[model samples]
Target: MMTVIGGVDADRLLKDRHRAMWALGDYPALAAEVIAGLGPALVDAVGVHPGEHVLDVAAGSGNAAVPAALAGGRVVAADLTPALLEAGRRVAADRGVAVDWQEADAEALPFADGAFDVVMSCVGVMFAPHHATAAAELVRVARPGGRVGLLSWTPGGFIGQMFATMKPYAPPPPPGAQPPPLWGDEDHVRGLLGDAVTDVRVERRTLTVDAFATPEAFRDYFASHYGPTIAVRGAVSGEPERAAALDADLVDLARRADRGPVGGPTVLDWEYLLVTARVAGGSTA
Candidate 1:
């Protein structure tokens, strides 16, 4: 049992408290969908044979970690956020299973080289500020024949289309609004991994995530769960007021979405992607 490295500071706790509150209101249903975002493809990819060591980066609330532990693998779930990790620990306890949960940054993993048989993230690495470094770290901690997998959102799906909607909220996006590198292009993905990746495969999957009944639904969720991070980032870049402005803009968008077809009880859409790749020299690769 490796010692877990996590401590909650006042700011982190406060930020996460807000994040939890936002999660309660924003996309609660969709959060479940994100839990099931990869479906069976990811579990199969992990090849979770009993006793194998696995590391799940950006494990969040233990979505992938749960399955890995249930499969009898000795697993560690690491994430940068403390609140999420605590939530994961509680979840593991509730399920009557044991998993090592750690608060660690993916870019600076604490494990030794080749420490894990498999390394993965459920659409997490794609969102890292230093993604290439993080990908290399995933490959670094994995053994020679180890497998690395990523469950990312595909471009042009319902989720992709939603990003297009987000653009309007930050029109002339707040200062320092840079385009995301992985909006939906294979080339962007290739650039992230470079050549250490011998084989890369992507499978499309459908996820009916109920984001919001209206655009306002979306805004409410984003404002709450994702709000603190966005606000800090925007504020740090001198766009301090962008958060409220964008929140307003997003609410307006949701109002427009209310007029969308199939608008009732909730907003639903099919959006998700299962991406599998290996860090060259794998027995299977």
Candidate 2:
């Protein structure tokens, strides 16, 4: 039986499942090692200044939030998964940076309008079920002239292809559900934020992840640590042959994209889009 919460659309129940999926594996452990460097880079790109109020939506393990706090901004790290939030708290504490952590939903942020000087999400908000609602919330929470920054995987990127590879094994998304990779498209982003902000800019960048000696080893690590991969693993668990075929396909894809064997370790280059925009009526500087 399907259940709806807070008068949300039936399809929106996927949010609950999404939450569960992320909670399965140790995302913080994996994210800390995988995308840690991108956090500070994104914070810098957003121009977070000292004394400004910064909100890191879907802040996994305080990656961007801790860096913002270190940059002298008052930071609030929010996410739907409590485990990830707890992990973020630990990270902030360990880094000796003060960050206010909150459990939050991106689509309908638990924040007042014009509440923050800067809002950001790094590979985070794109996962929200309702893209438009999430984009609006990101804009709505920013003060006029405030900046908003985001990073998302482009449809043509390695990560996007990886997602496509898992489609055969994973359950299909709800009908009409927007693809998360669409957030990486400049035109799609313009459509989403056009009315809310100005000076919108999008840039393509590459993020590299450490890979194991062989594609099979890399696939095993992702299958064990990554949320989506884990979900797919479970979905095909009962069917051994199907699971093997899916694994084989993913390994082949990895081999095709490999950019390693460079002495020490191999790496996979994942292309992502960086978006920066200013709330309408704000200083264009």
Candidate 3:
């Protein structure tokens, strides 16, 4: 199960790490609270119709999948982390919606080609180690004339800036790896889709998270539940001062970025890229 990309065997060396990172905390809980409303928004944007075969790739906790199912599409929720897929199953069950949950890698989906009428990912897929491979897989599994929708963090957005804040302390990405934020770029997204699709459209949107009372609270929550923050904390655990400094810097970032009134609940605005495209005819595998 070795997927070679950029001269590196990512399946052997990176996929496990990616899975472990996401498995660290209850991402479902965090995602439910922080990304509330985004799922439905994406579903609506994609115009998921009843009886359509929908696949939500890298579908963390069934966010988009549940909504798609609710909209009457036959949904399949797929992710690399089993725990996340399980969480998605629970969500589907609770909502009285049926979704086929699959533990599958975004870079290499387990489904057949041209299997779905609509393929969607919300704040997912971009994290895949091999961006090009992941993108191709997305296009590959979608039927010709089908639609693909994705929501990704823009490089200049707040969340992207937060990652930048932690970059100095965190190890650099794998050699030759494309940064996830590139998915946010309209031009880059066009390049990734290439001639596989048409009627490609990219729109910028903002999502607001109002879970914490202050910037410090926001920082604490992320440090505890967000995978990247948790990893960064562990990476600097042996160096107490470094960890503290990193925490302080993150708090400052939250404070400066907060758009809410001072002393009010922290309402952070995150800008993202929303992409929608129709798979071109004759591109089906």
Kindly list the per-residue Cα lDDT of model 2 for residues 37-85, writing each as its tens digit: 8888889899999999999999978888999999999999999888889
Candidate 2: list runs displaced more than 4 Å.
1-12, 262-264, 283-285
Residue 99 alpha-carbon offset, candidate 3, angstroms: 0.4
Ranking by lDDT: 3, 2, 1
Q: In model 2, what lDDT does residue 125 have?
A: 92
Each candidate: what lDDT?
A: 0.63, 0.87, 0.88
The model with the greatest TM-score is 3
RMSD, each candidate, Å?
A: 6.9, 2.5, 2.8
Off by over 4 Å in 1: 1-30, 33-35, 39-41, 155-184, 227-245, 251-263
- Whichever of 1 and 2 has more TM-score, that candidate is 2
How high is each candidate's TM-score? 0.72, 0.93, 0.94
Clashes of each: 3, 1, 0
Model 1 scores a C-alpha lDDT of 0.63
lDDT of 3 by residue, 97-188 (tens): 99999989898899899999999999899888778899999999999989999999999998889888888888777765777788888898
Where's the lowest-lDDT run of ten residues in candidate 1? 171-180
